[model samples]
Target: MQRLAGNLRTIDPEASESLRIVSYFDVLISRGASVDALLRGAAVMASAVVGATVRGRTIRRDADGRTPREETPTTSSRIDGGEWTAWIERPGVPAPLDDVILERLALGIALIESRRRLPGGVEVIIDAGMGEAERVAVLARMRIDPGALVRVIASPAGALSGADDAVILPTRRALVRVRLDRELVPPQKPGPWGLGTVVRADRAPESLETALIALRLTDERDRVVDASELGSFLLLARAFDPDHPPADVVALSALDERSRHVLRALAEAESMRSASAALGMHHSSVQARHEALTQTLGYDPRTPLGRARYVAAALLMRLAES
Candidate 1:
């Protein structure tokens, strides 16, 4: 068995490379090698390759039947450490692991995280702005719903809001944001999920506050699991920004004397249209402003925190002199 395994390792035939990697592992397991060790080795190699490729390292080939590694200028200089080369040199490489194929795996993880963090009406913000082809590629890599990514953009106020609120464009540079309902539904426990919250520093002026103070929520997902927990996870994630205070804390700070008045009018609004009329704008304009308020206030019906924003904005506006 040892001799056979040895022979398998020496053979470099393309047809046998995959078979060798698989059979090698089987033999190692039968010989009492730890399976976790094998897996860790594979993961280490995979991470290295991805880190290197993302940094632009390429394998150089010459007529000597040996391929040396070289890096291209086009490769971003941000590649991680040298551990990846160590993986290739390890006793046996795993089947799914490739010396040069790191992007696929890293992208898979990123895409998975993107889905895990899905926000209502949220989409993945690619490192480079995404296009149809890019979106298709991302979905394929992540194995997610095709419609998962939709176009979004920042508002004139520099808040990361959806473009559908104001102007229309075929392609635009934007950050991803998700919106939730105005009430909180109890979320199921023990689910595949995560939550995050963002808050802005209060001392800064309005323009800076708008730029920095945006709230986002997402569910850190693993395969299909409980719907309720997933929803709750997203709720918490949006509300769990480490840098800023809780959504409620920052939101209160966001509404100064005048903005508080506007929010009050908004909360009292029967519908977005009614809110518009009360704010003294066209219904269409009010809807845009309302949408902006919703983004600013981080109101989602699925969670208690969101409800507070919904209520506070309205109650505050009513106190203002008409």
Candidate 2:
């Protein structure tokens, strides 16, 4: 294909380059290249900066395969692929093959995205809507033992660094990663991540649900939430109504961002001095703030019962926001 493209470039550059574009993307799709690889390939092929937003995750690469500094493109050609988009950045006039490259890139991305969401694919394997028989069939196709243990990790779209062998599915709300329980490792990056309970391969749907719930419960202090550790708190999270939140949740929502931060610190800290240290405020200041919070929240958050109520309200507040 490269020889054909090089030879035909002498006679018809545009036609030859269009053929190259098609052939290049064909190889990528055949090999099941990742979205980042596709972007890099397009950038190198066009000898310009290429970018894409796939399922709300944005990525870019320059011709040298490094992320380009953020700047406005002087000239560009963009193509929309429903939930995604692809584009090339060039200076002055657009490259002759820019349009073809984007079209192929977009098409390749759509195919890969669709393939990952199809039946017997990553998405379906963790889809709670799928029946047990269907999930079992998917597990069989993926060569995973039905009784083998697995866990799901859920995070904001594009948050997790996926392993080559891991099954990653991008949903509307979160990125889902399914890995064998034994292979599970700490997340490679900082995240408000959710770790689901370990369960059989055929029961991944349940894991996904808890993973998402755990994700919703995460805050700045608690970046990773483990569903298995939540105990009865998970039940409370499910029973809480977003439309009609409890009085504490309402009070929490009414507070300013700074006040909310102080409240969270106080609720999670063991003592007033600890909360003050966490907030980087003097003990006197934290004590004064705590007194004001007690008046505002109608409870002393330092007490055990008050801490539980505050924590529950804070978690439920996140669910309401989600």
Candidate 3:
């Protein structure tokens, strides 16, 4: 089809380009591509940024197929597709094919969103932004008891396998699997997973929020973090401001990787000797590194207060990077 389109373009560029746009979206719809994928396709095809607003959430992708670091003024080529609206960001003047791309993009988005509203559409069930009445209706449609408990498991996109009973929805940060708590099984693969606390089906958005936070706290030492076990740590993660992180978080970010690894070991290990063993270094060497770390960080990571500070800084550092 692409070869034909390329050949046809040499004869009639306008008609060939229109055929190309239709073909691009038809293939995406056939494969059930995610909204992110659809927006990225439009962005690339139009050589500009594209965005969609669904359920009060706005997602955008740049022409390079990455989320734009900042927002810029956009062209007025927005198209409404029932449950969602799609737009192109071409600034001064729109490209010739921008209209067709935006039209097909909106059609693709509508098809995906409509399918997600059907029975067993776990996307609607776990969406925090959906109305209570709508959620209850969806639960009834899917034959899910509103009072029954469920958990939202969040992992990197395409990370989970054999999720036959769960609806895997792609969010900006992760792929969330919403399934009944009773049916939840340990993931088959190693994970940097965030397991949300079990909650009533209607309160899934709350679960998803904490699950994503727990995911952010995961590191090499602790690959899986359960939100139910977080306690006060959950509060700290919520209260942290990524845009203006605390001084300790900033300091931790400035250190080299080796220094950060040593600090992580010091924070987790019960003693200097244990820390050295974990790092495969001599105890005396670890002791000297600890002294240097104290001077560099302006705090003793081994002390009770300093340990708490280090833990917060390290976790917040992850949040900032994410």
Model 1 Cα displacement at 54 (Å)? 72
Which regions in candidate 1 have their CA more than 4 angstroms from the true location? 1-245, 300-305, 312-322
Tens digit of per-residue lDDT, candidate 1, span 93-177: 3334463323323333233334433431212222211234444454555444444322221222222233232211111112222
Native-vs-model 3 lDDT? 0.76
User: 21, model 1: CA deviation in Å?
Assistant: 82
Ranking of all predicted structures according to lDDT, beginning with the best and ending with the worst? 3, 2, 1
The TM-scores, one per candidate, come to: 0.20, 0.57, 0.68
Candidate 3 segments whose C-alpha is farther than 4 A from its true place: 1-77, 82-105, 112-117, 171-180, 239-244, 277-280
**Model 2 error, position 19 (Å):** 29
- The model with the greater lDDT, 1 or 2, is 2
Model 1 scores a TM of: 0.20
CA-lDDT, candidates in order: 0.33, 0.75, 0.76
Clashing residue pairs, candidate 3? none
Better of 2 and 3 by lDDT: 3
Query: What lDDT score is found at residue 14 in candidate 1?
Result: 46
- TM accuracy, model 2: 0.57
* True lDDT of residue 134, candidate 1: 44
> 194, model 3: CA deviation in Å?
2.0
